[model samples]
Target: MADIKLSGIRKSYGSSEVLHGIDIDVKDGEFVVFVGPSGCGKSTLLRLIAGLETISDGELQIAGQKVNDLTPSQRKIAMVFQSYALYPHMTVYQNMAFGLTLGKKGPLGGLLGGGENKKMIEEKVHKAAASLKLEPLLKRYPRELSGGQRQRVAIGRAIVRDPNVFLFDEPLSNLDAALRVNTRLEIARLHQELEATIIYVTHDQVEAMTLADKIVVLNDGYVAQCGTPLELYHQPANKFVAGFIGSPSMNFLEATVTDIGPEDIEVVLSSGKVKVRLPVLPGDLALDARVSIGIRPEHLQEGSGEVFRMSSRVKVVEQLGEASYLYLENGEDDPFCNEPFCVKTNGHSSIRTGDSVDICAALSAVHVFNASGIALTRTTTDSRYIAPRRA
Candidate 1:
């Protein structure tokens, strides 16, 4: 296991800087995931750690050693790319043992002088194959295996190296949904057995939420938030993270602060009819100051329970097996502004398009962001209405 640390890490390509100064400390055997939209510098950051890209500035330490000048092999790091990157001409065993064989050749052209080296390579290959359940297909070529099998071989090849850190760059992106789930479980199992420090990069929040011990959310080449899944979900640092981490995204409503109290603040929506009292810290909020309110779809319920009720017109209704998404039509100049505003209802919901329904959002579920998009801390008035807990 290894601890990876990045202090003021920065990356640049000519005049354009991709990664602004960023810092992260990944503990030994911790599963840390880098997640963000494309062009957010997640992949760039991973490559810098893997020695694939040069760090323009800042320091990177792996296992208590500074390795900014080291090669990938010198860093003792193994990476699994999105593409299998396997040689079709080689069998599974040959592919897994290839690295060891090349290493035995040393810096010069001559091979290692003993039979023990070959035997050791064979032992490591067999052990890795067995662990990944690829023993039966050791002699099979890459063409003979499925996509998921190819990925396992890729992982097993990395395992044979016994590297200090494992880097995964969207390893499961090529698999089908069912295979993705199975491969995800297999990876989770591998982490448990190996207890290896892993840095994974993915744009999929679901993968980040399910697989990571800690998640680093990047935005526009900067670290937006870094925390556990529940922390980012319940207590986002800004509006960007608040809107990105959740499914269907959080509903954003424009409102102006009308009343500020010690515990709760009242705001009037832009639509003029809805007035809400949200339990958020009254930090520098003044009357008539425009602020945004965020609430998750799941938190908006049909009935009231320490909630702020509002009448909405259902523009559309989509029924999944267990839940339904109700798209509300709020009066606004641009309809797209309200596109993110929707409510998740129970599966058996009878509401339909063009129907008027009353939706209530629990006070604790509301998120308040100031004009600068910074989230204000929420005050918990009732324990029952605390932020939604992760299951």
Candidate 2:
């Protein structure tokens, strides 16, 4: 296992820059995930760490040693790409053993013809095959295996290298729904058994939430937020982090600060007869300042709370087996959309489209964002509602 550190990292192509001064410290044996939308530089950053791309600026340190000039092999990092990238003509065993055959001198320096002994390669290959349950398929070609089986072979190939750092670039994206779930579990198990330090990149927030010891959310080439799954969920740094981390996403409504208090601030929605008193300090926000109120779909309950109340007409209702999502009509100035606001309700909810219903959220569940989209630090005089600080 290895610890990875990046300081003032930047990447550019011609005059356009994709990454802007990225700094992160990944602890040894930790699972860190980089998640964002397309073109957010997640994959580019992963490649930089793998030594597949050159870092235009900044120092990269692995296991406390500066490795800015090291090649991919010298970095001792193994990357599992999205595509299996398996050789069509070679069997699984040959493909798994291929890495061991490559020597610093040349292809001729392989175990079959050069320095490394045959027994060492066989031991590593058989161990990896057993670990990935690929022992039976070792004799089969890539084309003859199922997608999941081929994926296992790809992972097995990486496992045989005994890398200090493992890099996964959306390795499960190519699998079907069921296979993806099963493969995800397998990867999690492998991490626990090997205690390997892994840096995984993906656009799937669910994958990030499920697998990461720490999750980094990137937006427009900058890291918006990085924290544990629950920290990002319950206490986002800004509106972008709040909206991006949640599944259905948080609902943002245009509001105006009507009154400010020591431990609470009152705001009214622009196009609705709704007023909310949130548990956050006003700070530099003046009266009548435009702000946005963020509340997750699941946080908005059916009954009204003491601090907030909202009523809207339901436009659509999607009933999943576990819960129902209600799309309600809202104003044009709303952040998410013009017509409908999403709200999560009980699976057995009787509410239907065109029905008028009231929804509310507790003061503790509400998030307030200032004009620049930065979330206000929440504070409450009520000790019961205040969350304990992380040690």
Q: TM-score of the candidate numbered 2?
A: 0.94
Q: Residue 391 in candidate 2 has what lDDT? A: 70
TM-score of 1: 0.94
* Per-residue lDDT of model 2, residues 255-300, tens digit only: 8999999878989888646776788978899999999888888878
Q: What is the lDDT of residue 348 in candidate 2?
A: 94
Model 2 alpha-carbon drift over 4 Å, by segment: 103-112, 331-339, 380-391
Per-model TM-score on C-alpha atoms: 0.94, 0.94
lDDT accuracy of residue 84 in candidate 2: 82
The C-alpha lDDT values of all candidates are 0.88, 0.87
Which residue pairs show collisions in model 2? Answer: none
Q: Tell me the lDDT of model 1 at 354.
A: 90
* Residue 255 in candidate 1, Cα distance off native in Å: 0.9
